[model samples]
Target: MNNAAQYDTVIVGGGPAGLTAALALTRYRHRTLVAESPAAPRNAASRGVHGMIGLEGATPAEVRARAWAELDAYGLTERRDTTADDIAPAPEGGFRTMLGDGTQVWSRTVLLATGVIDIHPDVEGFAACWGRTVIHCPFCIGWENADRTWGLVADDADYAAMAATGFRAWSADVIAIAPPGMDRAEETQRALRAAGSDLVQGEITRLHHHDGDLYAVEMADGTLIDRQTLLWAPPQRQVPLVTRLTDTLGLALDDDGFVTVGADQQTSIPGLYAAGDLTTAWEQGAMNAAGAGARAADAVHFAHPA
Candidate 1:
C-alpha cells in the first residue's frame, strides 16, 4: 500500500467555506490540505455578489481570487485542484481520503465544505438568467434592481404569498406565478392583491431574455409579462461526494436533505465537520458559509489541541 500523506485537516472544497476554514486553521498554525474539484464553481453565472460586507458587488471570480490571495499570506495550507473521490474513517483514527488523481491522504479531521447543487426548474431559458436576474436570494441581488418589476416563481400558495408580499421591500411591482394544483390559491391571490401585489396562476412557458439579461416571462399561451428580476428558490441537493457518502459514512441529514451538524459544525460522524449550503439553506450565502467555516475551524482546533 502506498504511504498516505497526513495533515491536520482535509477540506473537500475550495470555495468560500473551504477557503475560509483554511484561513481559520492556518491562523492556528495547523497544517491543512484543501482539495477543490476541477469543475467550475456554482456561482459562475453571477453578475455580482451583494449583501456581503466588503465584498459587495464583487463577481464570483473576484471573490474567489480575493479569498485565494488571502490564503497566500498564511503559507500554511496545501491546495490541490482535485476532487476527493472517496472518504471514510481510517482504521487507526481520523479519516482517509482519496483524491481524484488517486493520491491518498490521511487527516486528523475532515471538513466537508462541498456545497449544494441548485436544481433549476424546467422553464426554457431559465438557466440563461440564473445567478444573474433569476436569483434565489433577494438580499444578495435586489439592491441594484430595486423598484423594478420583479417575479416570484412560487411553488406553493403560502410560499408564494409570503415571498411576494415580502418582496415589496425591494420593488413596488411584484408578481407571484403559482403553477396549477397550488393549495389555497384563491386565498393567496386575495392576500397578495390586498397587499398591493399581484399573483398569476399556471406555469411559465419560458424566460424572456437577451443574452441572459432577463426582461420578461412567457406564459403557456405565449403571453409575456415584463419582469426585470425573478426570485425563485429552487430545490437543492448535496454534491455528489456528500450524497454518495451519506450512507457510507453514516452522516445525518436533515429533513430537507441537508447534512445536520452540531453547534460547532461537527457532523454526526466524529472528526467529520461540514459547513455552508450543505448544512442548511437558511441564510445560504458565501458570507454565511464563511462564518460557518470559521466556527468549524475553531471546533476542530480545540478538539485536537496540543
Candidate 2:
C-alpha cells in the first residue's frame, strides 16, 4: 500500500476548471495536487474553443497546453494523471482521497471539478458531427455560421420555443427538432411559426454529414431537413467519480442532479467544493468552467489562509 501524501488542497479532474483552480491555489500559496482521470475532456472533439475573450480560434488542446505552460513556471502545483477513486472524511478533520493506482492522499480541503458527460441521442452520424456541425453552444459557433440553415433540438417545450426565437438572430431558416414526447403549447408553437421557423416534432434517425460538416438531418420517417448546422444540448449526468462522492457524502443536488454550491462554489458539505459542469447545467463551456474554478479557489483560500 502506498503511503498517503499531504497537501493543503486536492483538486480532482484536470480540465479547464481544475487547471484554473490549481493556478489560483498556487497564487494563494496553497500546496495542491491535481488528480485527473484518463477520461478525455468533454470538449475533446471540439476543433476550436470560443466565447473566451482573447483565445478566439484556439483549439481545446492549445488552451490546455498554454495553461500548463503558465502553471509550470510557478512550480507550486503537483499534477497526477490518474482517477481519484474515492474520498473519505479523515478522522483527524481533513480529507483522505484514494487514487486509482492504490495511492492515498490527504488534504485539508477537496475540490470536485469532475465534469459531466453528455448523452446524445442514438442517431446516426450524431457523435461524429459533435463540436463541428452538431453545435453545442451557439455563442461558440454562431458567428461563422451566420445566416446558414440551422436546427434546434430540445426536449422541453419552453426550451425549444425560446431557443427557436433566439436562433432566428443567427439564421432566418431554422428547424426546431423535438425528441419523442416533446411538444410546445399551441400559443408557443404558433409564436415560433409566426417568427419564420418550422418545428419538426419527431425523433431524428440520422444526421448526414461529410467530414463533420453537417448537410442534412434525417427524420425517422424518411424526411430529410437540409441544415448546415444544428444546435442542441444533449442530456448530461455526473461522471462516476462525482456520482459516487455525491451519494456517499450526502451533498445537496439541484433538480437536474447538479451539485448545489454556494456563490463561493463550496458544496453543502464543509471541506468539499465543486465547480464547473458538476455544479451547474446552464451556461456550460470552457469559459464558464474556468470562471467557476477561480471562484472555488477563492472560497478555499479564504477558508484556510496562509
Candidate 3:
C-alpha cells in the first residue's frame, strides 16, 4: 500500500458544506483536501436554496458553483473525481481514510459534508416537473410561484401542520392532500380553514403533466384536481458515505439514522466530525450547511490549536 498522504484536514464531498469548511480552514493556513466524486449537473432537480445571503432564489448547482469558485481562488486543493471509501481511526489520535481509487489520506481531522438524497413520491411524470412547478420547499419557491394554485401532498398529520405554515405565503387557495388514517388535529383544521386552505382526503395516484409543466394531480379514487404547482416535504436518506464511514470507524448513529454529533459537530468517534444534512433531519439548504461547516472548522481549530 502507498504511504498515507497527510493533511491538516480532509473534507469529504464538495457540496456547500465541504467547500465552506475547506475555505475556512485554508484561511487559517491549514492544509485541506477536498474529495469530490463529481460535480452534480446544473439541471439537477431542486426547488431552490433558501436562507443564503444574497442567493435566496439560486438553484443548488448555481450556489455550489459560486462557492467552488470562491474556494478555488483561495488555493484550496480540490480532488475532483475522487471518492472517500472508508474512514478509520488513526493511532496518533487522528483519522485515516481510503479513497475509491486506492489512495490513502491521513488527516488530523475529518469533516463529512455528504448531503442527503430526497425520497421522491411515486407519481407519474413528477420527475419532469421537479424544480420547476413541483417543488419541495415553501421558503425557496413560495415567493417565486406566489398566487398560484398550490397543492401540498403529504401522508402525515404533523407534516400537514408544518405545510400549513409554510404554504400560507404562496396562496390562500392551498389544498392539503392527506392519506387515510391520518387525521388533522382540530387546531390544525381550524388554522388551515382560517387560512382558506381546504383539506383534500385521498392518496395521490399520479401527477399529470403537459409539455413538461405540471397540470394536475389524479387521486386514487379517480378524482382529478387541477393545480399549477405542487409542494411537499421529502423523506430523506443520508448519502452512502455516511453509512460507509460510520461502519468503518465504528461511529454511533442517532435514532433517526443521522450521525450523532454534539454541539461542536464532533461525532462519537474522536477526530471525526459531520455537519449539515448528514447530521440533521430538518430541512436545510446552502445557508445551514455553510454555517455548520464554519462551526465545525472552528471546533477543529480549537481542539488542535495552532
Clashing pairs in 3: none
Model 2 scores worst on lDDT over the 10 consecutive residues at: 180-189
Q: Which of candidates 1 and 3 reaches a greater TM-score?
A: 1
Please, what is the whole-model Cα lDDT of each candidate in the order they appear? 0.87, 0.85, 0.77
lDDT of 1 by residue, 181-236 (tens): 88998888888888888788877989989987789889997878899888888899
lDDT of 1: 0.87
Q: Tell me which of candidates 1 and 2 scores higher on TM-score.
A: 1
Number of backbone-clashing residue pairs for each candidate, in the order shown: 0, 0, 0
> Is candidate 2 or 3 superior in TM-score?
2
lDDT of 2 at 175: 64
Best by lDDT: 1
Cα lDDT of candidate 3 equals: 0.77
- Ordered from best to worst TM-score, the candidate numbers read 1, 2, 3
Residue-level lDDT tens digits of model 3 in 108-141: 8999988777777788877788877887766666
Cα lDDT tens digits, model 2, 100-208, are 9888999999999988989987889989898878877788778767888988887777777764568766887786778666654455567778877667777789999
Query: Model 1 RMSD to the real structure?
Result: 1.5
Candidate 2, superposed: residue stretches over 4 Å from native: none
